[model samples]
Target: MPPVTERTSSLELPCQDGCVNVSIVVPIFNEEGNVGEFVECVFAALTPTSRAFELIVVDDGSRDASGEMLLRLAAERPWLRPVRLVRNYGQSSALQAGFDRVRGRYVVTLDGDMQNDPFDIPAMLDRLDSDAGIDVISGWREHRQDKALSRRLPSYIANALISRVTGVQLNDYGCALKAYRREVIDRIRLYGELHRFIPSLARDVGARIAEMPVRHHARTHGVSKYGIDRTFRVVLDLMLIVFFMRYRQRPLHAFGGLGLWLAALGVAILSWLGLLKLLGEHIAGRPLLTVGVLLLVVGVQLVVAGLVGELLSRIYHEGRGGAQYHVRDTRN
Candidate 1:
């Protein structure tokens, strides 16, 4: 090993052969008022760990004073690191940028709006130490402090549907507080609002997921970024996730099942006509013929649609140019 050289002028330095234990990744979007308070509480929460940590605040193209606040904090505090994006891509993209730049044994993600309690982070870190099999420890806000109808109601419905469809059995899938091991960063990818479905993605790759109740504080400095129209997107994404999770490797299964249903209807209609012929009845200008023809046509179309779906899935996922990861910012 080389001699440890300490820079007298600088208190903090980049990763020098694994000196840090945890990295906190916060995605900021127009929350300029709360950045200083958030970082202060985060550092106080992690101070008891006896391990060096870095607080990385990713600015997702805020037109407000968020970027300026981050720069100020980075200058005053040695442990504070700020990365800025060119424009506001979204929360998920900002988080992806944070995860890609993590240099710690474990990483924790939290929203910068100060809704998620930083005090609960230590409890999550303790859980990670106990269970070696656990890949991710998600924070479940059993007693959500948000507005009951507008925010809580939709989140409840979406969480129920997500549990039923994905079979992940997580209480609060949309909670912004969660801790992940370093290995999970390579396997799962996030786009759009898909960050809420991280538990499902981990389960797809055979990772054990568990949840514990955490404190939820109502929004203080900024407005709620999500709106009511997100309900439709959640439903649509649920169905797409079900299909991709179940039949990602085999395209024929998804399409073949639909084809069989259509073919069955066509056969049933034809059987009714055959019975009529056997009983010596006229089969001219019958409605059954039209029904059978339509079913057959639809059946063929569905099969063809399935085949097309498979070809596209393979081509896009396998192509080198096609990608899912997005960039918000990075540090040298």
Candidate 2:
């Protein structure tokens, strides 16, 4: 066959119709047994598409044969891009690596375990096709196949809390399958659990978001990884995301909001006490007075905290980096 022409831009290929460009990003942790079938299924799903596409598989230091399988597939298929991490970095890092490597105008991310249906890829693409302005098409799993306690319950609670906090009403946040427009992919910064918040982050940066119900299949290989501990982690991340989304741009706003509430209540209490004293009211040991003083002091402290947060943010942008979650271990 002809020598494969290589493209260098971030979006190396755009679809012929200029409709919806596509990239299939698969993050493989340790699913050694499923690699072959997964690739075959992905290619099969894309076989009839008229649009241009590429498959990027990130090997997160898989201790099993996943790395070798990806390497072998990469040699056979020009569209197959294989990335290897230095160690077991986890799924978020793997997905980010794929995102960094994808050159298609629209990037679609799916798990390597073969749980998320590649057949649904075109559904998301179709949604994007109908409306080009949409920045991301999130896959909503209406029929989840994982265990009720392990996956469904935790996911429901987390998704609900995240939606309420981020103000992005996508029904599913933890669904590993989603499609991102090239511009949307370019603008958002990816980190730790922020991958789950991509839709919200994109919206924060003025990108349109949409969601669709996608086909969810039961896992074909390996054991499920969800647990109660991870559930707590999800909640914790949600709270942090709430703070980041609401106050990241204006640290003063977040801290100051609380401060203002406290200060107002404190002032009201003191004002009432002062009016009582002026009227010859012997209200010396009123609990409101003590509470008011305490609230005032705390309010001042909160304002100071905002100032510190602002300075820290400035310093972060100046040279030093911002907060990063360091991974101590992963199961790949």
Candidate 3:
């Protein structure tokens, strides 16, 4: 294998001629120990399916031998295409880079770690291909192999919260072994930690989603890159998903609702204080009066902020020629 910088900078692999059936995208981040075994398993599993497939391995600025290994693998195998990002921009960004470059009818995503089985890819692809109505098939790690307290518990809580908030219930939001139709996958863009909410975002765009049980294996490689610290980021992304799902087109409605409630409360407080003063009570220097005034000011500020949000949302859509609604089919 060549040096990481030289290989990554010069390597460029293109999809083979003819239509591609499936593009398997795996985002690797410092998974040098597992690269060889992972690729071997993936090839062994997909080869039997006899599908015109391409393997897109995104080397997310691994500070190890991972990039070099991928370059060597790509050099020998025409199916393996290595995409090296300039630096580590997290898993979501790496996945986005792969997704942007895929040229297949079906796009599948799985983790680089050996924990997620590559064999699940075939069944997921089959499910999507069998039903035109099913645009996305998510993997459910029914019997997760991770620690119950540290990973499984928080995942369960977060999955439940996401199901309720997005109304697109799935057993596992953290599973990376998922399959999606090319059109469905291309309809949405990813940012931050939004990759976990792909199904939810797809649902927002009228995608039909389903879940199936997939095999999971315990890690036997380099240290796990993820931890409980990601929970905070997941929660924040979930909130963004909820907002985008419901109020992405009408930003004013979400902000205005809270603004109205706060303004109403503030007005009620001030009215009560004014009535007390009119009834011969000395309300000067009262804490309630100060709080009421503060609330009124904050309420007005919130309303102004809501207006600004509406303007920004308008600019976001119109400036970029984006549409809030997508049409499924039309006949004259």
Candidate 4:
């Protein structure tokens, strides 16, 4: 294996023709046995396609020989770009690293495991090209081949819940075989386990999304990285997505609204207690009064916190030159 030096520093290295038609980004973690076969299969699948493309394989701090294999393969395959992360920062960060380096008109993503078929790329690209209005094409594994009890069942529940909450209905949110137009992908900023929610995030940015059936194969190498625990993580990410979709720009609306409602209820209760006391009704040590006080204090704190969040939001945008809208074009 070649020396595993830091390759991320060369992210800005120039491409031959300034751009490629497609950039395929796959994040791998401890998949040494599958890397070579995966590359061969991808090449076999893509060789017939006339479109110029490059494959970016991200080694997410693999404890095995995956990184070394990637480096070796990259040396032989010029179209293959190897990204070796300093450490395991999770899948989302690895994908972001690849996305930051891609110079292509379309971006394709798939798991490094042999489960997702690379031949499906052409159809996804075809669907994207056919409809100029569609910004994303998500793959739906209509006939999944996985352990029904553990993987498939959890994925089914997650997909349904995500679809209902995000309103971006798709048969398989767990399928990593998806394609996005470069412009649409550029607008997305991934964090946490948000990679699975790309369709939803793209939709939030006004992207027109479509889904198509794709092929799926059982894993041949490496252990599955996901487990039942991912369900809880996905739920948390879903909550974040809901807030981001609705109140990313004006966070106060969410926090302040709830705060005001709680505060009102608290005030009403306290006012009734005060009236009772003024009438000599002896309201001391009442549980309702204690509840009212607690609510009032918490409500005030939430409102203040919301105000602070609003200020921080402004600072974040201004400091980074961020905007609520994206400008595709400007004429002099």
Q: Residue 323, candidate 3: how far off, in angstroms?
A: 1.1
**Whole-model lDDT, candidate 3?**
0.84
Best by lDDT: 4
In model 3, where is the ten-residue run with the lowest total lDDT?
A: 1-10
Model 3, runs deviating above 4 Å: 1-14, 278-280
Better of 3 and 4 by lDDT: 4
RMSD of each: 7.3, 9.0, 5.0, 5.4
Q: How far is candidate 1 from the true structure (C-alpha RMSD, Å)?
A: 7.3
lDDT of 3 by residue, 1-332 (tens): 11112223212333575567889999998999999878777776766676778889999899999999999887867778899988998888888999998888999999888889987888888888789889999999988889647787778778988888888889999999999988887898887878889998888888899999998988989887766777777789888888888887777787777877878888999999999989999898899888888878877787888799989888988898788788787999
Clashing pairs in 4: none
Candidate lDDT scores, in order, read 0.81, 0.77, 0.84, 0.85
Q: Estimate the TM-score of every prediction.
A: 0.82, 0.78, 0.90, 0.92
Candidate 2 lDDT, 312-332, residue by residue in tens: 888886667643332223996
State the lDDT of candidate 1 residue by residue for 213-308, as single tens digits: 988888889888876777788999887788878887666678867887997899888888889989998876898888887887788787887788
Candidate 1 at 153: error in angstroms?
A: 1.1
The predicted structure with the larger TM-score, 2 or 3, is 3
In model 2, what is the error at residue 182, expressed in angstroms?
0.8
